[model samples]
Target: MHFGIRFYLLASLLIGAATATLYFFKGHLYSRAEPLPLEKLVLATPRIPFSSLVILAKHNNLFAKHGLEVQLEITATGKEALEMTLAGKADIAAVATLPLAYIVTRSAQPRILAVIAKSNYEHSVVARRDRGISQPADLQDKTIGFLPGTSAQFYLEALLTNANLARNKVHMKSITIQDSQSALLSGDVDAVALFAPWDKRAAQALGESGIVFAPSLHTTHWTLTSNQNFPITRPRVAEKLLLALLDALTLIGENHEASLDILAQEMEMSRADLDESWEQYTFDVQLPQALITTLERELLWIRSHGNVPSGELTPVAPLPDFLDYLSFSALQSVKPSAVRITR
Candidate 1:
């Protein structure tokens, strides 16, 4: 009986060892056999909320599965994406509709391919209590700092409109994003208009002495744009990219925690911090019906705000051609319901 028991024990040990070895080899083989992305695409993304979807798609293997190898180049803001596209550093860019008004006028315009997502609450104003900026009304005659773009100008205008304050009531200062926090902390500006991680970090840096004002411009749309000549040359790749983005958007909608995890990782924010403001962002992959109208209004604001000369840029005459810049065939091919552009 003792010899029989010993033989059984030894046999069980050998079987367990062999099974473990086979499982390890099988996993290794599968990893080694994983196919590479058929096409490499470099995407330009502002280190803002809009970057989340593309980053998620890349990290979750959605792009690779769709045969795309995506490399994300971090930009200062959506405006920088357009510059990157024009300079040939990137194939696709994430640009805001407000900024597109100015960009569409460039001799070689960056073609807006699709709307990746829309968010009303992406930007915010963080003020220090020491500056006597406790309320919107208190902002009267106060100095404010904004990032280097019409989009930042857009945020400031919306805030002024909401407070019923005239443009002259608030002194505006243009500051680089990297220097904004220090500017605010040092009282170089009474208050600062910022977005996402920067605004959130500013609030945290001030602790109980900070006031975060969210005067959202509900008409804001985050869009995917391409270089002046990319989509026309490579329509099929652009289509595949749109399909992948649609998939990524679906994942973001259906799996909130998973998407948030990816955003937090890329944005370098703690999960808890991301959750605080994540709910405010709207994730959808539809060409908004109001996109053109919003751009028109944004163009007016841009002109009046003097970010660009109104006479030099004519959004009206070029508006129709700008609409043509969007290619909807790829979107319709993958998901019919998402094609909501009227005209």
Candidate 2:
């Protein structure tokens, strides 16, 4: 009877131990799982110089680190991507300032979250070897192809106006980047406004014939626009995204050579072109006072000049909208070691 009792006790002990082990492992597995507030975010991007972050985020798994599952969709135009956010099809969009400004003017009030990339007026009006274009003024009476209704178009127009060329003097064709190269080479268009990799490629293809005319003024803002309601509805998600973007922006500035290499791979451009492009780009994360002033001035100019209808130039409301959108709290929470606020 004692032997049978001993055997029962041994069996019970083993069963108990197994149950305890299972319970401990189950807790561990739960701990390893993603946090309760995980989010799935969709970000829209256009093919341009500022697309570095989109490329890096996926490759480096930065989003996953923050419990975010991100989907990046490359759209035909920045305007269309911005529209996706407005229509509730996208969670965030990395695009130019003009379209966001236009959307803001229309009363949708998409908030500017961060400045992704800024070019130092290096954008040029390039022409084919046969076009014989020398300056912005030469663009007059010539068919110039650009992304119409984009910041590039607006800036190019401003450049032409400053150079004594009127809008009526030039024939404008709305073209995409893929087609701009062929259009200029085939004599279908006289000139195209190209940035970075395209600029280098155009220069090589047309040789001395490719004339580059720098825009008269600088575009200091390449910004991100997001739906206001998203932040309100999903504050955690918005905060996480903004934090990740700022982190990415800072990385780009600190390690430009590496950043350019990443951008080159993403755009499928030669490193030499990427280097040339990097020289013209200013990757700044902080919204400087000068940049703010320039943006405000741009809004005023766009209104006064009728570049966009006056109703479309309505002042950016919820000053704190920008403030909240850039809140670094989530980033701070995730990686406090990365951010150093120096006095």
Candidate 3:
């Protein structure tokens, strides 16, 4: 009887062990076989330093961590990126408030997702000292090159206004920001108002002859924007993207040098240039009250300069309700504290 009892206990132990082992392996196999699929998202952004957060998110795989597979569509300028988003080629676009303000006037399809970064020194006037343009007042009668219907023109005009120079005093040349450096070097224009790192490149190209003038025009806000229906249709996707960017912002705040390395590589810029200009930008995710104020201010500039073609809007037509163009629900749901807009 004692031998039988001992044998029975041993068999029971063996069965229990086998069952436990089988259960563990079964669960492991199930996990391996049916892994969760990542949602695909397309982000259109300009290949500029302003897009550092998006680049970091892509490099670090933060989007995947949040269950998103983000594909980047790089453009030469924010205007182009915004256009792509408007045309349905991309789901999101990284753009500045100037372009956002101008585009919304013609079409109300675009909506602001978040203001990712702001910089007081993003726009500047790089001129050759040989052109007798050492001071802001010297810009008078000098041919200043700028991209029409962009922040470049807005900055140039604001700089002149701050200097008490009239708009007609300076001859404005319509040169693309990409061509600003060559235009300046080839003497196509005495000075070029551009955004970084083009402004930095123009300054470096001129060496001792280069003089960079940064007037206190307005703070340029770099924003992530989408179509009017995107956030409503795919709220989870929008929230996930913002969460990924929030992670990127945290990483940037913690590891400055490492963040700069990622940005430098992504932008194809030297580490030194990126480092030098890094301090000028405040990287964060916020929908500030200033966004509305800035849009209102820029709209006035847009109307006065006739930046938009008359065919798009009649002269007497009231300005767009900037508030209507903003979509705050996604950011609010992800991080309520970050949404500073009153409405």
On residues 1-343, what C-alpha lDDT tens digit does candidate 2 reach at each position?
A: 9999999999999999999999999999998784665579988887667667766766567777777899887886677788888888988887776676555555666766556567766466787546656766777789988875567666677678788997889897878877878888888899887665566677678787787776547665676677777656777876677567666776776876787777777777888777765667666444444445555555565665566532344344432223333333433454555333331
Candidate 3 lDDT over residue span 1-343, tens digit each: 9999999999999999999999999999999899689999999987888888999999999999999999999887888888899999999999998888777766557889999999988999999899997899999999999876677778988999999999889898887767889999998899999998889989999999989999777988999999999989999999999999999999998997888888898888999999898888998998999989988898888887776632455334578788898888889999999988876
Best by lDDT: 3
Compare candidates 1 and 2 on lDDT and give the better one.
1
| Tens digit per residue, CA lDDT, model 1, 177-284 | 888899988889888888778888888888888898886565578888886578778777788787787788788879978788878988899899888877776766
The top-ranked prediction according to TM-score is 3
Which residue pairs in model 2 clash with each other?
none
Q: What lDDT does each candidate get?
A: 0.78, 0.68, 0.88
Q: Give the TM-scores of the predictions, in the order they appear.
A: 0.83, 0.76, 0.88
Off by over 4 Å in 2: 1-38, 249-259, 308-343
Total backbone clashes of model 3?
0
lDDT of 2: 0.68
The clash count for each model shown is 0, 0, 0
Q: Output the worst ten-in-a-row residue range by lDDT, candidate 1.
A: 309-318
